[model samples]
Target: MTSQKLNTFLENNLQELKDNGLYNEIDTIQGPNGSEITINGKKLINMSSNNYLGFANDDRLKVKANEATDTYGVGAGAVRTINGTQSIHDELEAKIAEFKHTEAAVAFQSGFNCNMGAISAVMNKNDAILSDELNHASIIDGCRLSGAKVIRVKHQDMDDLRAKAKEAVESGQYEKIMYITDGVFSMDGDVAKLPEIVEIAEEFDLITYVDDAHGSGVMGKGAGTVKHFGLQDKIDFQMGTLSKAVGVVGGYVAGTQNLIDWLKVRARPFLFSTSLTPGAAAACIEAIDIMSSSTEEHERLWENGRYLKAGLKDLGFNIGDSETPITPCIIGEEKLTQRFSKRLTEEGVYAKSIVFPTVPRGTGRVRNMPSAAHTKDQLDIVLETYKKIGKELDVIS
Candidate 1:
């Protein structure tokens, strides 16, 4: 309980992280997150941001944010349950519901908070959750917090999911069963088999949840994965982040009006946390407008992804089975992956390396997030640098 004792414990854990080369050092970005960014006074081709549609720095979004700030001031001032729920907040939620083609929607402070709030609110101690093995950390934590018996099925293994779902339902021990997955896997860039998953859920009468954090602005013609598979009516929870593809900061859950009503009443984060600012809410509404009106950004993002992935593949680098714009250049060792990232940075690219325990051992990678903002010339530069560093590090032949 002493300060010295706490310091010693922190030091020991910090030392462990350092020894494992997993100590995350925060890098300061001096400018906007875009195709190119400034970090530590150096400019680099940025492939690390989740700004899929480049709306983070977009003029339209900026103008909306400014106008909202001017009209409504800065903060919501209190939690949503109190006086924090502004008209803009309700408008944004309605827009999200419209965009995802759901009956109702509710917004939270962050995407992570939405998962932590919504999942725990619905599935309690008596319920059971069937989660994908590779689901996001937020989902894993949410499941744990729900006090539900969480059973992680193998990633994208429908056979495993079907067997587990059938067994769980037949057992009849739990009050409710929920099946959850990320619509698009972030690291490997593979998409969830939602069509098959939905079929299995229907057969077993399971509640369906899809966290489309990376898929919202990137898939289903910008509506999301549930929309992509035409399973909007089947899914119970269609979760997404306004911060990523939408280029604003917040999270939302779109579902039946009953579900949204339950979350507004029961979700802890919604009840206890302050709502999103007027500016963020307004910017998000504008973002959805842009997403619905044009497919140019989505098309360009896929084009860039194809260009980069093809170039890396032609150079004999192992670009994993990514069906989305997220491309990972898998390097076997942690040290090599880190070294690859460092080399890329020195050569003016900013793709980050992923190592254990973010990923499994021997699956370390330099993950690339190719955005709609990236130009052909920028991608060409990244490719040339990759080839140079790959040759030097022997990552490619």
Candidate 2:
């Protein structure tokens, strides 16, 4: 029983969102979220998942998840600080450290929670964070939660970053400063200027943090964006998600042993929340092993990305300047973008429209995430659908 006023407030806001074409309709997939998904009994080519490596439905990961479940049940039973730190959890952390080329690592229940925990754990009111303007929502929320003075530098503009870092540091108002950016911008599929970021970080003695959620298993031969730039050792915090390219459920921060130790003790989520289930932990470890052992899936992902991008570009869609497979067909108006996405879905493609609040105004786009699991034929179908919808909607000739 909530208050009538609270209910009224929620109803009014929801109605406003619907009227403004900003309310998102959540779709449920009938089976595993793979290259193709079934929604309302209609199968569509899935170009919206973060299953970059196709590990979500991989047989090897399934076997590992089942095996771990048999050995350790479904739940962790308690928070990590209490009794949830099972051997598998520890093993996962060790493998994460190995995979990321860090001295140590710690895991959290989710990517957002990990960022929230990690950012707030080390940064505080006395510190200032020089963040990229295009960093993830999780990163933005984490900074807000950290109570730190946040200065957003223009996205991947190293010169702006340096200026902000210098200003923040010389101001003498903050005890420490951190420069944080995403390893890959998920929305545009553009990579962070890590090399330049690192140079600026060194010049200003700024602690470098990279949230490589979209970079892992897709860049650096499956190591990640920091590793792609060969700056793993220099980054103070290298955070990533097991749910994205790894195709499981969790997140981790790979860093120095001292930093990890501090996070384990201080990160509120790790301290207060139950750990990832044994199945998720084991599946994630196997994912890392797979990523480390082979490059087939990673290569296929990039190949699919290139193919989709090339086809979409050849079809005359305004695909943004993306270095990776996350293709965004920039449809300028919100309602038009939503209509475009709906037409796409009706035509058997499952790409979704991203509008203002998620992206800036007048930059609405239908984002496509090409994964390793998507076949040539499947992609061909997608391309055909896009062309059909593009012409019908007058997005292209």
Candidate 3:
């Protein structure tokens, strides 16, 4: 039977969240997630997906996925350590390594698991991790799970990172030290200062890891943020996801052959969880090939981002300091932020509100993710709706 205490705890917390406008109401996308989406049978401009290159529903990827599915069954039979490692999985890893300019790579079931497994695999109670204060939730949890002493470095503050790194090393309490940060901060859309970060890492002999989940397929002509800074050889662990720009589902870490080999045997998620399905592996391979060969999608994505950002800025909306395509329309109050997003949906755009926990309280925003699939006409409509909603809601005057 359900525990009575559990029921009471859930009831109280759920009500409190709703009352405070902290509760997120998930919208059901009735069709393929693309430049436009359908929710509750109504069509809306889709600006809130990680499908950066518009490859999520691309025919080429779908074709490859189908072929792989026909050749191999739906799921890998077991974990990679056992008999689950399929041929396509090997091909996918190789493709990832080549694309990321690394000697080798290892795949994970998801981006979250990739961080969880990779961090704990090499770090432990004897180590300390210096992480960006605004790093993704997965990175924070990974640091915690490693049982390491986690030091928070101020967001994009290289001076703070250097100080903390020196302190951690000089403390002499930890056996090893590592620095982890997101290649692209998804919220503000600012990128990590990789050149300075690498210099600091070298000075302190610290292992460096970059989780480029948003950067891949969107930066360095589709290679990622590390390559954007020409630091592929400098970073130790180059972690990324196939689910975002790759338009598939999986995560990977590309580095030296030895690093990947260690993760293959040591990362518990790889050892215990089932490998990615053959279809997904094949689709990921296709996506990497597309990224390596063409800049069409990548260029288009940037264009769309610029168009949207200019529109919002011209309309006097506070779109934070975004270096990438991710644009956020900052709305202060929680209820007002949620209301803004709702009004946007009613007016035909699908931008969603990001509140506290996702972002800091009082910094609530309507995060817009512009993809390559979006056309000028669609974006124009989105801007018009935004202008109307902005003035009406007093989010902008």
Candidate 4:
């Protein structure tokens, strides 16, 4: 018994999207998501995953997951404030704090929830947040949920941030001011100017929050961007995800013991949502251990990134300005971008097209995420396929 109005709205929007070539068709990946993936019985090189270190399918993490599952079953059975605060969860938080060089930490179910809970918990209608223009969707939504006056600072523009922070502070309208940004811009693969940001925050006495979802385990020898700039004690909030580089399924905020204590009591998700499973917590702990002990995988990931970027650039593809391992093969037109991605898939590569409004219109791109598990041979095949498809689609010379 669907509402007629809801049905009409859905039908019209769906039809409009299809007509405008804006509809996204999802593909199912069979088996483990690693260097290669299978879709519709076809194996293709995988380059669209966020598994930065290839830890998603690592056997060490798998073994830890299995052991924890056997010992604690599957679920935590209740919210963390209830009876779900297991010892493993405490260990995970402590590990995250130690790894991030923070005084304490609090865990959440997902990165998005971490942002939503943390932002709203500290900020209210009388507060203000200066956010980067290119911050992640989760960050945007979290700012909105906070009921704070959100000032969109230009992406990585330290001058703009300084100006906005000064204005917010002088306005005397807010009880507290905060500046939040992604430690690494995911789409552009650009690192935030943390030293400058810290300076601005210090000048304005603004609270700092860094969502290092893409930077954790990829930057600062696997600590994060804050550590990358030696600002471990400078930032107020060091937020990150276990689902990305850590290759598990949770999020956490590492900061002063006071902040963690407040979040534990105030963040709605931690109060009402079920805690992460024992398996996930243990797997995350193992991933941290592996990262702490070695830089082999980290070095491999960067080497692979450089190799692929060089190959694409030599072939005349419009690879965007990326300072990190994320490579985006930009194709201006939306329909053309979609077609190019489809051709790549057909040619044994599984890189997907990213279009508006994920990115700006006409800046459509096929983003590639090269992982540590990717061999040179597999990357060569991917490059060859990209060459074949890029020429056929007239996306490159």
Candidate 5:
């Protein structure tokens, strides 16, 4: 077939996405991703970023990045195994180990890559994985890549996890079993029941993996979910992102020194991809310093989350059962959800609507990410706008 014919075939398949209001358009941010941001020449109170601690645009991080770039250049120049491992990368990993209260840590290019690399590196086709139904896409992909038997348990249902874990181990058909879950569910902001999970893992001899992507800077006073449950020693894998909370770009796995060493030798990304830039590595170290020194940013973030969630609830929107700083205003239909997001942007709030495929169909939502950088006055304005939009859309009485 001709190239033009193939293009037409692809375009036809995409028509359904457009017709169902699932087609996503890219929006360019004109300024720094901060409490308030410029998009399309309009300033909006940004609520869609994962920068919960608001360190992405922090002056200290910027200064550190500049200094590191001056000292070590812009890139690491080769894959980690082939002379790409800079001193700063080692220092950053050490810093992360200290921050996570682990014996050692390994950094990857992104959180997605970390999951893809670590999970597959640890388990093989002979093993089995008991995963949360609502775990992130990265975890799902990693399990698939591992050549393991992937069994998904119900979200946060310890009973289901226990049952599946027991079945996997008792059958004795698999060489090993790993139980994995998101430390914090990104969409609903609900924390994983780590204590219960750890107990089950112990009973079944399953390796415990917790992806704390959204929990790192927002839970357990910034040490993450393992710390939140005081199960740091019990969890086998403590996966997290420097991009989201730490305000830089990278992902990490924190565990025993042996685990870190194994990953360094076996993880595909670590062996094959270039290391994180010196600037990002240095900035991430600085972020860990900030998170460890005090809880001021974390406190400010929760205060803002509570304030905004309370305001939205008072207006009668269906804010789901989110126990963390991540909040979602559940709007039923995809079109309505997108319209709601558009209205919020028009009224100067930057929260984006999430629809099917990201969540189950018909359970579309507008996810709000409150940051430490947002002042009370800014949150108040956001609340007022939400109230106005909610009333207009009949989302609230």
Candidate 6:
């Protein structure tokens, strides 16, 4: 029997969420998540996965992973501070630093943990973090963990960031100030004004941090957003994930050798958790190698994105201003957005609806992530389905 107090809390909160149309109903995918996926035995054109380059299902990655498992076994065996630091792990970290053009790099169990560990490791109550309002949830939690005064600057507003930086610096209330932002804003698919951000960082002598989770292998010809702007040396922290475009499961912070060394000892996740599997580490290295060697996947991704975006726009859907391939079909009402997503699924498309408080109330949308593996015909089918649904729902005239 469950405790009344605990049960009541769960039941009431969940009920409230459902009542407000904020409850998320998860769909079970039967097989690998790629350009196409099966849900409840129904195959759909997948537009909701972060497999930007389709590396997750690539045969090359599978071979590398299989080879690593055969050579090193499945798990890392222990926490990184113990016996988990395999040679492949070291090799992966070296490649991360090389790919990002940093002096050193350190890997973590996940991107969320990377932010949580890296932020708290360096920042403290003696510091202040000037974060963009649209920064990821992990970044928000990481700031809270740091015990620092977090000042939220307006999203992509350089003037506001500059003003906040000036005020934070002149206040003299903190010993150190850091400016952190997402290299690519996930929801709106817009890019952070990194050049302006770096200039402001220089003027304020602020530590620069960028979480390029969405930008890796998608921007800078697969290098990242920092490399996109050629401001890598100006930024202090470059955090990214191996799970997204890299097609593996891990995260890394690339910076100076001292920063990597400090994180190795100071980052709680690194010290407390087992390192990435040998297979994942090996696959990550090969993925980077593939990206560096050829631009086929990168070019294919952008082509698909442009094709999808152009088609959506031609159909009179509001895709917003996306600098990346992430497309959002903005629907004004939460319930309507959910219904639209349902309709899309019914029509053999698998785009997910995002509503408040994920994207602010009344600005709900069906977020579409087009991957490189999607054929033009598959995308056209998606487009045709979307058009029918939009017309049926009166979302477009």
Candidate achieving the largest lDDT: 3
Write candidate 1's Cα lDDT for 1-397 as tens digits.
5799889999999999777767666789997888899988999999999999999999999999999999888999999989998888989989999999989999999999999999999999999999999999999999999999999999999999999999999998999999999999999999999989989998999999999999998999999888888989989999999999999898999999999999999999999998999999999999999989999998998899999999999999999899999999999788778888988999999999998889998999999999999999999999999999999998877
Poorest 10 consecutive residues by lDDT, candidate 1: 17-26
CA error at residue 86 for candidate 2, angstroms: 0.6
Give the lDDT of residue 230 in candidate 1: 90
Per-candidate TM-score against the hidden true structure: 0.98, 0.99, 0.99, 0.99, 0.98, 0.99
* Candidate 3 lDDT, 306-381, residue by residue in tens: 9999998999999989999999999989999999999999989999999998999999999999999999999999
Stretches off by above 4 angstroms in model 3 are none
The reply for model 4, stretches above 4 Å from the true place, is none
Model 2's lDDT to the true fold?
Answer: 0.93
TM-score of 5: 0.98
Q: Which runs in model 6 stand beyond 4 Å of their true positions?
A: none
RMSD of each: 1.1, 0.9, 0.7, 0.8, 1.0, 0.8
- Please give the lDDT score at residue 319 for candidate 5: 94
Q: Model 6: per-residue lDDT, tens digit, 65-134?
A: 9999999999999998888999999899999999999999999999999999999999999999999998
The total number of steric clashes, by the backbone 3 Å criterion, in model 1 comes to: 0
Query: Where does candidate 2 clash, by residue pair?
Result: none
Q: lDDT tens digits, residues 1-397, model 5?
A: 5799889888987898888988877799997899999998999999999999999999999999999999999999999999999899999999999988999999999999999999999999999999999999999999999999999899898888888888888898999999999999999999999888888888988998999999999999999989988988999999999999898899999999999999999999999999999999999999999999999999999999999899888888899999998999999899899999999999999999999899999999999999999999999999999989998998888
Clashing pairs in 6: none
TM-score of 4: 0.99
**lDDT measured at residue 20 in model 6 versus the true structure, 0 to 100:** 78
Q: Please, what is the whole-model Cα lDDT of each candidate in the order they appear?
A: 0.93, 0.93, 0.95, 0.94, 0.93, 0.94
